[model samples]
Target chain A: MPPRPRRSYDQFCAAARALDAVGDRWTLLIVRELLLGPRRYTDLHADLPGVSTDVLASRLKDLEQSGLATRRRLPPPAAAYVYELTGRGRELTPVLRALAAWGAPELAERRPTDAVRAHWFALPLLDAVALEEGLVELSLEEGDFHVRRGSDGTVSYGDGPAPDEPDARMTLDAGTAVELGRGTLSVADGVRGGRIAVTGDGPLAKALRDG
Target chain B: MPPRPRRSYDQFCAAARALDAVGDRWTLLIVRELLLGPRRYTDLHADLPGVSTDVLASRLKDLEQSGLATRRRLPPPAAAYVYELTGRGRELTPVLRALAAWGAPELAERRPTDAVRAHWFALPLLDAVALEEGLVELSLEEGDFHVRRGSDGTVSYGDGPAPDEPDARMTLDAGTAVELGRGTLSVADGVRGGRIAVTGDGPLAKALRDG
Candidate 1:
């Protein structure tokens, strides 16, 4: 493919240089999606609703050019293309986390015109959950999702139900979920106050309830 | 002023929301400028070269609408209009700092076409300086500028020479300056190794050399 034009601020400042790479509209949001794991083009298109096909393609190309993401094809039975972050791209985790924390208060109230998806809550809640190594199924009015903290210290979340029986299931109202995600309320406070109903007999469930 | 259209990823995620506000090109760069202090429209334009008049005006309006910045008139003798970051906008310091630290590696080499202003180094170097409460004049090969750590703990920098006799003056090459700003080289290390020459007899200079 021909290289798309490279847009830059052209300043020597580090922050300006960083912005030159990932500061465009929907670029970081695309990063947010890829951060979950590799996703097929269709998967990304579906998750990121309202993004025009052109913009998505352009941003993905930009990411590839910037060495933040790459396009790869699966082998054998799953011979499909997917986009994933590069090691340099994965380094954006902290930058995304910082932005997520800073913009948490903005999520206190959702606008009527706003569009939300199940996994949109994943990043913030990932930091809120204390499970060392377990799959956590979360149920909210918006939708159902699951969070997993691996023994290897990697955390990831997905939409809908857990692929397997979860170690813990948390059912809570949207308000409580928003507060917890905003970090205004702790998991212990929610569990003790009965805002979040924790279920399952696993150690993760027991630890959450004991909090 | 009329409200410009607000572009959003429409996702409920906090990072997405932040990108909604600051994800636009030149927005965070403008935020970086305001972090230094308030400035007139002309001043911002001068520092931020290559930004079209229309885009700059549009971004300033976007910032004002987002409550990140505001415009106000100065008193009497110099009754010029200036833009400054609101308290909420100032909260982006950490966000900018994170981006700066992450993007520091990208600044390893200056592109031939890169445009740089003296004050561009101010923000990154702000965190590198060890002055508790004094004015620090930094002389780089690009140009000279000053950073001040006020008694109130507020830090600010300006282009050109110090406004008054500065408390301390340090002269260094652009490479060492970039390393120090990137946090790879410590101030003490720079001083001890003579990469940075500490020149003033003030307490700030004494402390810097003792390191």
Candidate 2:
């Protein structure tokens, strides 16, 4: 890409330059949707209802100009265009995650849902540093799941296979796993309370309880 | 504030919530500006030369509603007002700094300064976790500055009278510091070559050079 003219150092004193690029309300949200993966224009429109078609087009154009997003055609004869993040746009993920973490509590208070409740646990995964420290093994049985804790407090998933050296194993459905990650329930507490079952090493069970 | 009505799980989504709030281009920029300090409407307008008054006003309103910014009257005449970040708004400072760091190189290449350059260093002080380790003490004398490194590299600055125990003390004007930070000159090489001077503890001075 040809370089654009440099703005004066004094120009850096103002926040406008950054804001002008992503300051608009719709643009970042559009960027956020794209982060989950790419989607066609119609998918975006459906996802962001109440946004006028013209405004969406304009925001997308502005995003493209700012080097945040780009559009590409998909499929045969469909001419369906999808927008995806460029490298610059992906950089905003941490910002979006931080904002979400800050707002999550307030949002949960206002809208109590099974999914919203689950999000409380899962959202922290966005912080890879924290995730690497905390996660242990996850194991699934016929309808139950087990969680084992490592000495370092990392949780892992172990299930179903012929691995004799297992930490803690539980059996649960996929939805339950998703919900547990989302923070909907305390997996350790659930097992202790008999809402779930655990069949594994005692230390691992205790660690899961502690976690 | 009264509790808000229950929202659906989808509403808790970050992008959905952000769009429900500032979702336009100008509001985030407005938040960014306030982070440096508060500014009056006219000052903000000046900073964002391209944004029309109507759009600016709309963005301000959106920001106010989102709890990211608060507009306050500056005494005497209620007609005049300044916009400042709320606590929630100030949380975005790191995000803004990261974005600035990512964008700075590209911006510098495109727009080289024409006049005498002023150097500015904005390391994140409150959060040590955000910065890389390195402590260098700098002192100015006769339009030149000297740097000395310590055993532990924890960067800090003090604006008081000099202590008797400084490892090394070199002096230079602000412009030179700015230039060095921008990679225009190597601090170690400059000192060794006598383009810059070094006095006091040689090991500390050498460490600063290494840094």
Candidate 3:
């Protein structure tokens, strides 16, 4: 492969520089997908419904060149290639959270042409959940996904529940989760109102109840 | 104008929903410009050098329809239309800050074609500064700008020092400011080294020193 030429904004400002790296359409979203852990190209394509195959491949390449992601082959049994975020790339959680919170009001209603993903709600719900460091499993009507925030402030989410025993698990319906994103309801309020159920005996559940 | 349709990603996820709203080309960059308060169409055009007139106008229109920005004629004496971010739009500070921080490492050098703005560096410096609720003014070689965070976590920044008396003032040379953004130098270290001058008896300067 030839050396990738850098075509940054060339501006000194950090925001512009950052945009130069991830400002392209579909780049950050790719980062959003990979935050779940390593994913095969086909899995990435399935989750990111609207992106073209060419664009997806191109973005993965850009992310690799940008040092935000790395591709590796699964050994033996799986025999597949996967892409995953690096530590620097993982720093984007706060950025995604901020963007998701800012854009939540835009989702008042779903369009007929729109696509749905259950794990997509993870970042916004991150703010709604307790700040305690633990895994949170959410069993929504549409599908299941889980979110975990570490003590160092790193946050990651993936499809289904925690791989290990989750610190806490919540069986929340979609309506309650959407309402929480809309700022119309709180987690504690949802729990109290029976809109959301708590199943873990961790500090997270305790915090949610007290909140 | 007929009711501008809301073409949302019918996804249940907040991050996807956000991308549906702000995922368009140059949208967040426009948001970056508007964060400096308001700008005349001509001003926006000049600052956003590479954007074609048509795309800039179209993006501005989308912003207005999305309620992220609005246009109004300046009163009487200096009558002209200017676009400004709504309160909801200004909420992007943290998002922008996160992005700037992530992108800071990529600013290895400046190219000749790059246009430099003193204020363009503000977002990155925001994270470098103290978390106190006060305005800090910067008089750099390129231009002037100010940033302030409110008690409620609301942050607003603009082209110059506080319109009135700023809570604090700091005169930072370009080199020192860039160093701070790059994570190589601390604000206190700069202040102590005389590369950054601290002024005013406000809590901000005190915090910078302690920081």
Candidate 4:
């Protein structure tokens, strides 16, 4: 795709420059979606429920032009174009994490009109858990999702069931999950208090069970 | 003023909530201005060079409605309305710093079209210098500015000269200042190399001189 004209803050400040790139309404949200892993346009649209199709397409193009993401076709049986983050793009994960931590207080209440997805809580929940490496499938009242903690320290999560058999499976209500994300509740305490049920034969399951 | 209706992403994610509040164009830059301290409308307008007057007014109104900033009139002799950041708004400093650090490399080469401000480098330079507490007046070729390092761990910087006599006053060219902000050059090295001239009888000056 040809690059669109880039709008700039035009100031020499680094923060301003960063904001120039990602401060648009749906830009970082799109980055968050890409951080989960590569996804087809349909998948991204489905997961980010509120974004308009036009805005999503424009943001993906912007991400591509900015070198944060790229489109590639899958080989063979699953031949489909998907958007994925670049190394420079993945560096934005920390920036997203920082924003997530800072904004956590705002999630104390879910307004009557609020829309939600089980995977929208994925990143914070990933932060809440402590594990060196494992795949954990989470079953929340809202839906089911899976998270992977790589030995390389990189983490990623997606909606629905795990792409493969997960090392651990946890069942918890959305309230307990939100509490965990807010740091008001701990995974150990949740497990100990029986608010969270763990099932699996992996080390992660053993740790949760022992807690 | 009555609150304006807010537009939201409708998601339950903290980062998304934050974006709903500050993700608009020029919102964070306005936050950047308030971080310097209270500013009259004219002052904000002058510092933020590119924002349209209509947009600025709308953003200020949005910021007020969001509890990020508030406006009040100065007492007696200085009876003027000024906008300042609230504690909630001030908490965004670390977020800005993270973005600044992450975006520093984007600042390596100044585009001929880029706008320059001496005080714009203040936060990054403040990060560059290691200090417990002191007021440092910095004279850059672009302009003069001052930075305050408070004992309480709060720091602030403003355009133009120090409000009062400063503990240390250092003079250097804009290039050296940019280098300092980028962390490519240290204060000690700049001092020892005679690129930076430090003057004053205070401890900060003495440290800069002895180095």
Best by lDDT: 1
Clashing pairs in 4: none
Tens-digit per-residue lDDT, A8-109, candidate 4: 989988788888778788889888988878899999998788889999998888888878899999998999999999988887877787777768788988
True contacts kept of each: 0.84, 0.14, 0.75, 0.76
Best by DockQ: 3
Cα distance off (Å), candidate 2, residue B72? 8.0
Compared with the true structure, what per-residue lDDT tens digits does model 3 show for residues B153-206?
Answer: 666778866687877778888778878887899988898898887787867878
Tens digit of per-residue lDDT, candidate 4, span B45-114: 9888899999999999999988999999999899999999999998887777777766776787788878
- CA RMSD for every model? 3.3, 9.4, 2.4, 3.4
Ranking by lDDT: 1, 4, 3, 2
Q: Which of the two candidates, 3 or 4, achieves a greater DockQ against the reference?
A: 3
DockQ of 1: 0.65
lDDT of 2 by residue, A1-211 (tens): 5644323323432123444466564666676666645678887776565568998998898888778899999788877888988988876765565555554434433334322222222233333212222323343332222223346854332222423444444444444443443456566666666655545555544555555
Shift in Å, residue A44, candidate 3: 0.4
Model 1 off-target regions past 4 Å?
A: A130-137, A144-169, A199-211, B130-135, B146-168, B199-211
TM-score of every model?
A: 0.86, 0.52, 0.92, 0.86
Error of 3 at B181 (Å): 2.4
Q: Which stretches of candidate 4 lie over 4 Å from their true place?
A: A131-137, A146-170, A198-211, B130-133, B148-155, B162-170, B189-211
Give the DockQ (2 decimals) of all models.
0.65, 0.17, 0.66, 0.63
Candidate 4 or 3, higher TM-score: 3
For model 1, residues A1-211, the per-residue Cα lDDT tens digits are 6785788888888888888899888888899888878899999998888899999999999999999999999997999999999999988877887888778888876887778877777777777774668999988888898989898988777778999999988898777877887878977789899899999898888877775
